[model samples]
Target: MSVSVDLATVWAFIIAFAVFVYIVMDGFDLGLGILFPLFPAKADRDVIMNSVAPVWDGNETWLVLGGGGMMAAFPLAYAVLMPALYTPVIAMLLGLVFRGVAFEFRWRTRRERNLWDIAFAGGSLVAALAQGVALGAILQGVHVEGRHYAGGWWDWLTPFSILTGVALVIGYALLGATWLVMKTEGELRERAYHLSWIFLIAMLGAMGAVSIVTPFLHVQYTQRWFAWPNIILTAPVPIAVAGVSALLLRSLAKKYDYQPFSLSLMLFALSYAGLGISLYPYIVPQSITIWQAASPEKSQLFMLFGVAVLIPLILGYTAWAYWVFRGKVNTASGFH
Candidate 1:
């Protein structure tokens, strides 16, 4: 209602949008990395690598933006969350570092290409799993007492967190496979289509498991979803997510090359919306409300000016990179 309240809420939404963009964009390339080891043929793997090479770095820009935005706009949340999630956060960064290094070094090595390939795939797997675990740990809730994490070091390693980690692996694999379906042609495209279906089924199973388990783990979340008027308002979120998934499955079944990828993006959007709704007004799940976590209004407004300028530039060049590299990856051209 007040100016500061509006500022905090706006910043919260901005941080969420940045995170959503990162997940959808980086998710596919990370998916590609995860799929690297699947195709045994060296040439086929080269094409897959090339398909993502142009935009992979640009795709990661959103991640930096998201982290930086949160640190700037909601410093308290960043402080509390970072310590609470230190282990997985470190693992994720290490995985990403391995992925980036392997992506570049693979092109240069003649005898050691295989080693890099293994690293790429392994890195992707670790990063994806760590991210998922982090998500589950947050959703299951954190232990905070007077602005500090109160849980043990191994609190993030629970069975539910591990399950969520596996789900994220499937989800990212689906995103990658669908992306390949869009950008590739001939045998690779066909292969991608097949993998997309496999990953889709896996994703469905994971989502179903997480869906069933989430409410039982978090009473507030359960009440929010099932309580009369709130349930009426929120019911469409899951339904829309299901519809998107169905559309993706149908597209894959029909062998509609581009539609599967587009539908996957829609699915990501809906799922993110559902997540944001479920955790509304809370930057650190149930522990810290947005207003409690937000920096001063003047600080947020100052940061907003920079974000407004930077986001458009980031978007423009990301679009340009994609447009420049549009088309099926030509394997014969070699890794550049």
Candidate 2:
């Protein structure tokens, strides 16, 4: 049998892929920014910011690409999701604005730089938490009435959603700490190594609990994933995550031959891959399947053509940005 082009399906996959990319790429930077204050000293905070300063803005381009692409490619999905997620979305956007302002003003606004730093940290935290709440709500599922939600105002803020929010905070912070370890040397690097153990364990614990809980809540996902050949295909997720986690731990334990940051990143990527698997084919999970919620073929094709051109350009610039600023960060240097 041969596969045929389902334009809607194709667009759905592309939008999903873009979102995953954004999460993996920009997530760490935001996480690091949020984790900045965890450092015992102001000098350490400066080091952390310097590590992220070069590519922090570039890291966020993924969100726009993922979001805009979703709106264009899957208009129907957006119509349904936006109303359901309205408050959290507003909060997320506001937080992102704060995060952005904090990033920019922190450097130039001398007397108010401290204030901006706090704002930046607060924004990052809020945005990350809001996202977790959104994800948890999506996973628990929702009731739909045509393209809008039938669920009540507070339905999106369930116990599961709140748990997910807290989990993500630790997850992001770990990512940030690992990233700092990877990009900085000397004292800051060592400190990041120490931080990774606690945060990574918390992330894994949260993920473990979620994995067990998801199946019972949505039997369809459980049966589909845990059944036969599908289970075999899914086996790699836990295995890979475990392998990376072990590597991260081994590196930390040994300390002398450490590559703390890069390995931690691989760990994050693996964990995210597991999430992508768990929520497969449902852009919004059980609430809306991809094909059912897709926009028209003509619309999707037109949007795809544009995205095909746009994605490459975005990838190119992102690569260039990272290359331009590749190196270890040190104290006494401005974030220019």
Candidate 3:
């Protein structure tokens, strides 16, 4: 006998894949901006910005896909979660807008360059923080009475949310430092290696804090992680994280160009997997599930067809762009 397939689960994974791609792709550039203040010289900033200039905007395609796919494939989750998360969502969008504008305008002017640089860093910082807080708010649980959200406006704001926000900032900064280590040369690379040591330690601490706090936020999370038979499957995640952390530390210490960035991405992927373990089946966590929130089967089928065509095209172009732009970004002749 053949098993039945679930479209909702497929769509859920698709969205998850998109979001993860966005985090890793756009993440490094946002990190570059966050680390902008540390490299105050004009030449350093120019090289930093140029490293990502070819592909920064394209990276946001996944963000749009993730958000739009959710609204289409999981309308109920969208309806309920939006109202509950409007503040951070809006803040995230605004931050992206400012960062995008700064990316362009910063190159066009000299006198006003510093202001745009500030905007670039500030916007990146805000976007990363808001994303983390929004994630924490969702993980902590949203108030749902019947089909609609019943929470107050400030419901998203909390100590847990704040902690997650700070954690993401540090994590993105780590991604940025590692990217610099991979893509630059000489003093910039040296400084990035130093910063990587600092950010890696900070990122680990943040990850530990989030991991420790997560189980207590819900009994289900505790059961999923620590309860009996489940631990057999879940145990390897942390172990793999430990192994990867050791490799990353060794890579950075040895000053390997590419391994640091690759290892950093692995750490992020593991953390994301841990998150999925905590909140599987439930799109809204503690409330709505993927099946309950999914659109009609016919609607899902129609959209899946579109996604099949769209995703490959996206992957093709994205891969081509990166391949074309591959290798170290030279300070003498930038992308611009």
Candidate 4:
């Protein structure tokens, strides 16, 4: 039997899925960018770049799709959200651009490698900080004036936002550290494994602080987590995340080389899944439900047909790229 479905629900799911992919894919690479400065050797650094350089550009495409889908499917949300976030958005874009340019031009010219290295690291920090701020604002809820945000510029950069910023920095570092455990070996790999515990602990502490404070900031969040069936549904997320993190720490501490990184990756995935589920229905988080934020069903239907074609093509190309470059990086090699 065929069932009639709400088109806005479908659009919401698609946008949400795309956002998930962005976090899962680019999240780690951005983690790599955040951790790029830690590796002390030139060859080891190449290996870290090797882990993400081929896929980083492709990973970022999900963000574009997610954001574009949001803008097209919910023009009202876009109108309100973008202006409120223009400064951080601009900074994020600039950071990404600067890092991308440095990534390419850096190899092309030997003379400016030092300068470009600084740019890459600096760009990573800026982008990560802006993203964290944007996320914090959403979680804390913006001051909505009719259809617009009525908050000060400084309002977005609250202590909670700053905490999230540092939290993500450590989280990205955890991703990178785990990545190194998987991809590199010898002392470099050992250092990465050891560092993961330290950073993971830091990430846990930050998340703990946020969990305590989030409920006080908004009533709906309190109800969502603390009330009735929602608590039962949500309890598994934190429990699972904790279990996985503990296992990952145990493995890394024991110097279990092969699966430590993968486990850490799984832990990250589970945590992000909880976040997506928690924030479901709210594109702007409590300000607007996906249905209220949606464009006409006709618009989404047209977009869906195109997305169905383009998404698979993107997946295929990403797969092919990984297959073609399926080896560790070396400083001796240059892009051909």
The list of candidate 3 runs beyond 4 A from truth reads 1-5
Span of ten consecutive residues with least summed lDDT in model 1: 327-336
For candidate 1, lDDT tens digit of each residue in 52-164? 88889888888888899999888988988888799999999999999999999999988999999999999999999999999988888888998888888888889999999
Candidate 3 lDDT (Cα, whole model)?
A: 0.94
The parts of candidate 4 lying over 4 Å away from their true place are 1-5, 330-336
Number of the top lDDT candidate:
3
* Better structure of 2 and 4 per lDDT: 2
Residue-level lDDT of model 4, residues 82-182, one tens digit each, is 87778878988999899888877777777887788778877888887888777777777776778777777766778987777777677777777777676
| Window of ten residues with lowest summed lDDT in model 2 | 1-10
How displaced is residue 190 in candidate 4, in Å? Answer: 1.9
How big is the positional error of residue 153 in model 1, measured in Å on the Cα after superposition?
1.0
| Candidate 3 C-alpha lDDT tens digits along 1-336 | 111138888999999999999999888888998999999988889889988888999999999999999999999999999999999999999999999999999999999999999999999999999999999999999999998999999999999999999999999999999998988888998999999999999999999999999999999999999999999999999999999999999999899999999999999999999999999989999999998899898898899999999999999999999888878875896542
Candidates in order, TM-scores: namely 0.97, 0.92, 0.98, 0.91
Q: Give candidate 4's whole-model lDDT.
A: 0.76
Best by TM-score: 3
Each model's C-alpha lDDT? 0.88, 0.77, 0.94, 0.76
What lDDT tens digits, residue by residue, belong to model 2 across residues 1-336? 112237766776777677777776777877876776776476777777777776787777778877887787666677777777888888888998998888877778679877887888889898899988888888888888766678887788978888888887888888787777667778887787778888888888987877677776687778767988789988888888888788778877877333666776676677667677777778776767776676666777777788889889988998898777777777865433
Candidate 1 residue 70 Cα shift, in angstroms, is 1.1
Full ranking by TM-score: 3, 1, 2, 4
TM-score between candidate 1 and the true structure: 0.97
